[model samples]
Target: MSTLLLSQDQVKELFTMKDIVEICEKTFQGFGEGTVINPTKVNLDLGETAAFPPYKGFMNAMPAYIGWTDIAGIKWAGGNLGERKRLGLPYVTSLIMLIDPKVGNFIAVMDGAFITNMRTGAQTAVALKYIFNNGSSEKKPIKLGLYGAGMQGHTQTLAISELFDIEEVRVYDVMKAAAEKYKKDMKDVVKGEIVVCDTPKEAAKGDAIVCVTQSKDKFLLDKWVKPGTVIFPMGSYQECDDAMLMNADKIIVDHIGQCLHRGALAELSEQGKITEDDIFGTIGELAAGKLSVGDYSDGKIVCIPIGTGAMDIAVASIAYKKAKEKGIGGTYSFV
Candidate 1:
């Protein structure tokens, strides 16, 4: 027996944003139905010195088993915002190891950064399918507000474009150049106007708002968020003000436990401002046909996705199979 090795570019080539969204939808549905085991990721914090001061980074071990796919995998995912950014590299880097369910042997290892970015965006798409569109195939014109014009921002735009007719996309980054780059790069990708905003407030005025920044402090204020907007904060630290949580008409998460551990609402959870009960429901539940967001259409909504290992596994498993069938990757024999 041998294990196949797939590179990041190879993995990216194996799936499109649409393919990823579909896979993530199935994964979430199965997760909500209790057909998947997604454990809380274990984080190993490397204090501020790992990067520049005030910007600590971490590595996490995320493991999961998708019963429907009959595959088990673990992703070694980590990032250092300051250090990597200083070197002009991606803030996050990851590798996934896939295991055969029956033999308990490692079968493949693949680059996980692409999977991570696409799956994270796909997660929001899945949530929108049920929460915003109510699981309908009909597309609506959407104006999207985005904070942090980075890779995730790009992917988020691509994923959302698959489901909605993007009427406009407003983007803001601390660096004006970054926002301009996003506009230039995405102008052709999104069949809509891509506006580079001068301020976060300007960017926050759309149908839906997405924050993918690495800010340790809050930049997205509650006042900036208009009513009838869905906010997706995908960073590890809190980007939105506590009022965004306290005043949101409904708060949905990919996983409740993960929401408490890290991501947008972790501090609020730690401070007892909100608890699991405060959450309306998980995206998985909504995707599973157990809950609906139709009642909250006119109100402000927030969906916090920490990104799950099952999603990584689902995409990775399929990539591995495709690699083997096409003889695309190098293999290391173990027998």
Candidate 2:
């Protein structure tokens, strides 16, 4: 038995933003139509795991099976909150395994960190399609405000820029050097000017806001963002405040059960600040036009899509297919 092994760089080489976006769109439609079987993630407190000593982190297992695509997989990731700055390592690292359900064979082993970053960003773009430009109609050029200049931020920028026609990308990070580096690295490549912002609020001023921070506390003020701005609060809602979630004109979640368990709504659910009724609908519903949200071109909206397993599986399937065509990655006998 042979399983293809893909590194982070190989995954990056195999994945294109446009293709990833298409995969996400198709997978989301499948989700709405009940053609997929992706359930809520199972989170483990890594601190409680039997390590040499107590650790300070979390690990999660996300499993899914897309019957229509005949794809089954699980993605597992673990990381500490401040490990990146303190340990000089990635905050979150992950791996995924694809299986042929009929034979129960481990088909491939690939780095999930890159896939997670890209697919999460692609999911945000999918939500944006329905929120900002429903029916795929072109709207005015967008001015994008971005928070956090980490790897996830880079993926978010790359994914959104590839899919949307943005005029400017104003980025903010507590570390000035990081934001500067993001600008320096991305300015030449993207169509828009990459501007470094002095504050998170500065970065939050635009037609759309994307918060990619890994911070645990809420740093964003509700007043900072403009009315009718589409926001993607996707980093476990760590960067969001109560007002941002409470005041949004519309809210979409990737999955309601998943959200309630390990999503932006978890905290809100605890505080009695929100209920399922407050949610607009899942992104799947919006993508399938099952919801009756009209003229979303001018509304303050937010989507909280906790990264789902099926999204990763669908995208990895695409990448695997592409790699087969392009002869990418490495393979060796596992049996």
Candidate 3:
């Protein structure tokens, strides 16, 4: 069989946020029940070395075998720290490969950067589904708070809007221009007001706050986060400070193993401030009813979904299928 090759633009044409979220729910639910096969992601830090410069960024290899669809694949992605500074490129750049489980043949090649961002955003939506109301549904107008305005931030906003009726979006970025641009661009798409805030504290005052920055230092402080707020820290690390994790009443993660190794809660785990016991459970558990997503009505909660490979492949699988059905993407035979 010939393989399908999909570009970023083609994937975008075939991908739907609502469908992506639904597809993610099945994979995530299976993962919680120990049915889906998703190994802990591998990370390579290329810092301060002869082969690479220091503090730029590293690469990650995330592979998964999603049972529901019977597709196995891996996402080979990396961050080029110098590109943003010297070449005006985003730190992240990557692609994904989808294989046919029946024949063990490589079946597709697709741009992973967009897939990654969309899945990451969908995870946040999925987390909110489980954590927002104990696996129930919410219909109230959402007051959204944001900490970053880059590509990830934009996609997160897009995904959340698909799930909730966001009446207002309060955002803050270190670069004022980025924040302004995010608002200007979102105005036409966002039904509600997109307000720019001067500080992270101002941005954190929403019912649902999402932090999707490349921050190496913690910018969000606990003093700004009020009770009954649900925080989604999407950055790999150090977007929400230690105080939030320490003070949160309940903590939910997409994958406990992955989050412990890196991402929002890794530093907190390393510092001994937060432990495995403190974690409530994976978002999937909450969705699958295996673990309790008790009411956070009177308490503060945090969800850190450190981007799982299963979700990545799940979305890619959808793109591949849709592209095939719609006669999209290029065809190649390497057999």
Candidate 4:
């Protein structure tokens, strides 16, 4: 048998954010219906070192199977934030291995960074589609507030723009240059106006707020969040305070177990400030038609997406297929 090998550039050509969003919808639906098997990711901590200090490094092993698609895969992903500044390397690096579930043989291997960011952003888009009742047809333009102007930040705007008519995007970062760069880079990417804020609070007043920062500290105060606003905290660490979850009318997570392990609510769960009961349900339930947001026009919702292996496999499988059809990837015999 030959295994398909796809580089990052090849993977990017195989799919778009629109494609990812659609697949994510189906993937989450399958997850909710118990048609998908996504194990909780196992994390390996890499303690702080002088070489990778301040950021601390870690690796994650994420494995999943999509029964409907008949494919299985695992993602070996890791990141070192401090190394990015020191060594001019990417903060996150990942590779995905697609397997034929029947024979348990590797079918393809591909770069996962693009897939990671796109799917992570697409997850939020999927959540908003079901959680928020408002649509672009309402003629009420969306004002998006963002904390952390990085890769995920860019993709979040891209994904949300496909669902809402964004009139403005207010972004805040500790680095003024980064926020300014985001505004300039996203000017044409998003039809909305991009504003760089001096403070996190300035960016929190919006129709929807998203946090994709690397800050280990809590920056999003509950007081700054307005009513009827939906918050998406996509980072691994806690960005918003406990009240953000405590006072929220609805709290939907990508995976309940993963959320407790390392995402937005991890710290809260560890401290006994919040429990599984506090969570409304997984976004999968909403996607699968098992639950609905139901007239939440006046409610505050927090959707925490910690990233999922099922999504990675779903997207990777499509990319592999597309590459095969287009004759775009290298093949190596594994005899």
Q: Evaluated with TM-score, which candidate comes out highest?
A: 1
lDDT of 2 at 236: 60
Q: Report model 3's TM-score to 2 decimal places.
A: 0.93
Q: Write the number of the candidate with greater TM-score, choosing between 2 and 3.
A: 3
Q: Give the TM-scores of the predictions, in the order they appear.
A: 0.95, 0.90, 0.93, 0.94
lDDT of 4: 0.86
Better candidate by lDDT, 1 or 4: 1
- Best-to-worst ranking by lDDT: 1, 4, 3, 2
Which residue runs of candidate 1 sit more than 4 Å off their true CA positions?
48-55
**For candidate 4, lDDT tens digit of each residue in 173-208?**
999898998898889866768889998889998878
Q: How does model 2 fare in lDDT? A: 0.80
Q: What is the C-alpha lDDT profile of model 2 across 193-267, one tens digit per residue?
A: 888989777788777788887666788788887777888777764477888889888888888888875556678
Pick out the ten consecutive residues of candidate 3 with the lowest summed lDDT: 46-55
Residues 1-335 of candidate 3 have per-residue lDDT tens digits of: 78899998989998687888788888889888877788888988766122655766677899999888889999988776664558877677888999998889999999998888788878887777777755656654678898889887787877777777778999999998999999988886578899999877788878889988878788888888888999988787768778888888888888888888687888878888778898988888877789875767778898888888899898898888888889998888998
lDDT of 2 at 37: 86
Tell me the spans in candidate 4 whose CA falls farther than 4 Å from its real position: 48-55, 134-140
Q: How close is candidate 1 to the true structure, as a TM-score?
A: 0.95
Q: Which window of 10 residues has the lowest lDDT sum in candidate 1?
A: 47-56
lDDT measured at residue 24 in model 4 versus the true structure, 0 to 100: 91
Tell me model 1's lDDT, rounded to 2 decimals. Answer: 0.87
Which pairs clash in the backbone of model 3?
48-54
